[model samples]
Target: MRMRAAILFEQGRPRPYAASRPLQVEEVALEGPGRGEVLIEVAAAGLCHSDLSAIEGIRPRPLPVVIGHEGAGIVRECGQGVTDLRPGDHVVTVFVSSCGTCRYCVRGRPNICPSGFAARAAGTLLSGARRIRRLNGEAVNHGSGLSLFAQYAVVARRAMVRIDPDVPLEDAAIFGCAVMTGAGAVLNTARLEAGEAIAIVGLGGVGMNALFAALAAGAERIVAVDANAEKLGLARQWGATDTFLATEPDCAGKVRAATDGGLDTVIETAGTIRAMELAHAITARGGRTVSAGLPASDAAFSYLHAQLVSDEKSILGSYMGSCVPERDIPRFLGLYRRGRLPVERLKSGFLGLDAINEGFDRLAEGGVLRQILRPNA
Candidate 1:
């Protein structure tokens, strides 16, 4: 079978970059899954900021790569030894794959799986091969192990997370990335205990997810801060107990005031130097701040040495919610099923694969939550 994809031929252009635009939709041959692999006929895929980052150079990668990563679909084929899944099962594709025996994987962190640094960023499978290619006879890079922008994604069986067949593919797709990263930061990494006060800065995809996760985890007070008032309102629906519009100078003071001096946990997902600084200062003594945002090259954070030494404040950088997909993915799906995660709030709109460019526009518009690309539907 031949599939369609949006390939990044080059980089360093403009916001959304040439990578997001001029999407090349062509029929690409569907490669058969090898051993321990599964072939997925993609139904829905989400356009994440990370996808935009790679294309716009906020997050750099090799050229000629296919962009979308968060995808959900049905199992079209399964390779040998894959007993857990078969054709016709619905699943979401997780980009990070673990060797399972590595130190990180054994310790329960597949987000930083040992083999990922090389395999994922190189746009190839763990076995050093690319599964997606052009029908005209050219190779396409599979960013983050799954080239989900294509109509069909060929991925490892480990990357496929089986979900309830009835869950909407669009909702299931966003869970693969944004939901896990945000929710995991709170549930897995922070382990936010009940009655604790929490603040989530930057209320973007990941930040919003953090708020919802905090609510589900039973935090006493959840404060959401953002420069955009529109998103701050969305934060409330996602379970933010308080909303603070971050504008002008000294917004940190407002955050401190709202939290009654300092918060138990501060989650930074805005990816700005200012956001990082605010998060650091607003955290209470003995409190911890978890950063899930991917800051740009020019971003920097400054703090007084005594603040760390005397106050006992700690800062943590989280990747993929410190998650092991095999475990966390299913747990996240469970949250969605029970209505604790509010996965539906994360999505803004849906578009067809040919309308992929419009999805990026919605992302750039600032108020949009998440835009999905529906290929099969």
Candidate 2:
């Protein structure tokens, strides 16, 4: 079957948005899944900031790659030996894959699974041939482990986590990326103790999820800081105990005042130098500052050596919130079902595959929460 998809071919160019540059959307011959593989008819995909990064050249990828990592859909085909799942299952895709026997996977750190770079970035599944192709005989690269920007995707069976058939695919799409990153940062990385104080800077999809996770973890006070008032307001609606407009001249100072002795943990989700500086300022002695954001390569924050050493402050760069997706994704979904995660509130824009560029535009505008794509629409 042929599929329509967004293809990134060059750097510094806007993602082929206009009709003149409209993404090539045509049918591609389907290939059978190899061992341990499953074919999914993508129902909904997310326009993640990382996709923006790929377009912006902050993170470069091979040309003509289908660029989406967070997606949910129904299984269409199951390869040989796939006993645990079957067709018609609703599922979400995970970028991190586990060999299961790898040292990291054995240690329960699937995020650091040894083949992570090759497994996700190789532009294809472990089988070594592209599953998506053009009728004209061209091939498309898989942008992460799952090139879900297309109508159909082929991925490792292990990369999928089954969800209740009733939960809307749009709501589940963001879980693969933003929600997992934020919520996992708290539940796995920071693990904010009961009643601990936390401040999350940058309320984008991931930052907002972090705030919600902190609340779930029993943090007594959750102070969320963001320059955008719209997002700050959303943070409040999503269980942020306190919301602070980051534009305040002394916002970090106010954060410190909100939690005497400073915030027990400061989550720097903005991935900006300014946000990191603020995170350092408001972090209490022995507090851990977890950085979930990905800033530009040259970005840096300055601080006195003595301050970090004497205060026992630890700054950690977290990738994918240190989550084991197989385990955590299901748990996150359970939280959503129980009224704890509130996944539905994160939807800012719902668009079709052709509207993918507009989704990024809304996200860049600074107020939108998460922009989702319905490929089959």
Candidate 3:
């Protein structure tokens, strides 16, 4: 099948992406799903910072890739040996395609499954196959095992989870990445307790979801930190106890003071070294700091060695929010259905596939939260 899709062939193109045109929408060929895989007609996909990182060269992947990891769709066909899902079933994509026998999968930590890691590094499906091609017959790389920027995708069975048909695909799309990562960091990774003081740095889609999760978890004080005042305002609207602009000269000091001499936990989702530092600075003694962001491959940060030992502080890296998608996605959706999660509040707007480049522009300017794409529109 041939479908219209967004393809990233180069990185670090000058911003005003609409002008420089970083991602081109072209007619591409998609092959049928292989064994243990499924064919999906993409319903909606979200513009996430991780996708932007690839465009900015912060997180490099093989060129000529379809770059979308957060998406939801309907299964159009099933490959051999796939009996659980069938045509017309709604499902959400998971970036990590864990091989059930890998050590990480056996231990209930599939987010870092070794096979999934290698497949992502090589830009192929978990089965080590390239299912997309150019009209000229050149193979196109898949992004995170599920390149969902197109009208359709062929992904490993492990890369998708069936969802309740009643849930809107646009709303469920974000759960694949931002919501899962942010909320999971709070509930699973941090295990935040009631009455615990917490702060979330970076008020993007992921950080905002963390803020929502903190409120749901009954955190005593929740501080929202970001450089954009508009985002800070949105955080307050969403129930943040306090909002701090990261641009403030003494932002970390203010966060500590506001939370009565530092918070019990701080979650950093900005994917920047500076935000990580601020998250550390605002954590109370013996507190844990969790980072859900995917920083550049070469990026690094530093902290005082004395603080780690004397304060007994701990820093933890959270991938996919340390989530087991099959377990967590349903649980999170239950929260959404009960009106506790309110994940829909994160959406800024929707666009067709043709406007994807402009959507990235809005994302780069920090003006939109989550822009949904209607690839079939």
Candidate 4:
């Protein structure tokens, strides 16, 4: 099959992607779903900071890859050995296509399944096969085992969750990454209880979702912090009880002072060392500081060992919010249906495949949240 897709041939392109154009909109050849795989007509794919990180070479992905990790689509075809799902089913893609027999999957920690991680790093489907090629037969790599930046995607059956047709696809797309990672940070990793005081540092799409989750969980004091004043304002409008500008000096100290020596949990979602530093600083003694951000692969953060020991503060790293996609995606969507999650508000707007580069430019500017790409539209 022929389809329109955005292909990233190179990384670390300078800013103003409208000109650098890290991702080239091109027509590519796609293959049918293999055994144990499913073909999907992509409905909506979200532009995320992690995608930007790839564009900026903050994280290295195989070149000439179709780069999109989060999306929702309608299943078009199911390959051999697939019995549960069929054509016309609405589903959301999962990056980690966990092998059920893997130790992590057996332990209910599918988020860290080594099989899924190895496959993504190698830019192949879970079956270890390359399913896309250029018009000239040049093999192309799959991004996150779900190259959803195109009109259609072929992925392992385990990499998707069937959703109700009533759930809007455009809204459901963000659940693949942002909602799962952010909501899981506080609700799953931190296990924040009702009436507990917590703070979300960095109000991007993920951070904003973390805020919403905290609010729905009955957090007594929800402090929202970000370097952008505009984002801070939006956080207040959403549900944050207190908003702080991270750019301000002594920001952490002020938050601690206001919260009577800091919040019970401070979650860092901004994927920056600066944000991680502040998140640790604002955690109360014996409280936990959680980071769900994806910074550069080699980026390192240092903390005073004595302070950690003396305060008895625990620092946790949460990947994909430590989520088991099958169980948590629907749980959060239920919250959205009940009017609690409200992630639809985070949609900045929509774009076509041609504008994907400029979309990243806008996303890099840090003003926009989740920008949807209607690949077939």
TM-score of each candidate? 0.94, 0.93, 0.99, 0.99
- Least accurate 10 contiguous residues by lDDT in model 2: 15-24
lDDT of 2: 0.81
Task: Give the alpha-carbon lDDT of every model.
Answer: 0.81, 0.81, 0.93, 0.93
TM-score, predicted candidate 3 vs. hidden true structure: 0.99
TM-score of structure candidate 1: 0.94
Mind giving the per-residue lDDT tens digits that candidate 2 earns over 234-320?
Answer: 777777878888889998788787778688788988878888988888889988889888887667778888988999999887788
Candidate 3, 73-135: lDDT as tens digits: 999999998999999999999999999997789999999898998999999999999999999
Tens-place lDDT digits, model 1, residues 1-377:
67777777766555453244645667777678888888898898888888776756777776678878788999989888789898999998887877777888788876788686688778787767777767777788778888888778888877768988889888899888898889989988888998888999888778888888898888989988898999987777767788887884788887787667889799998877888888887899889989988877566787888869899999998888888776887888888899988878777877877777667766766777778888776
lDDT score of residue 85 within candidate 3: 95
Q: Tens-digit lDDT track for model 4 on 1-377?
A: 99988999999989899998899888989999999999999999999999999999999999789989999999999999999999999999998889999788999999999989999899999999988899999989999999989999999999999999999999999999999999999889999999999999988999999999999899988999999999999999988999889988899999998899998799999999999999999999999999999889999999999999999999999998999888999899999999999999999999999999989999999999899999999
Clashing pairs in 3: none
C-alpha root-mean-square deviation, each candidate = 1.9, 2.1, 0.8, 0.7
Model 2 alpha-carbon drift over 4 Å, by segment: 14-26, 297-303
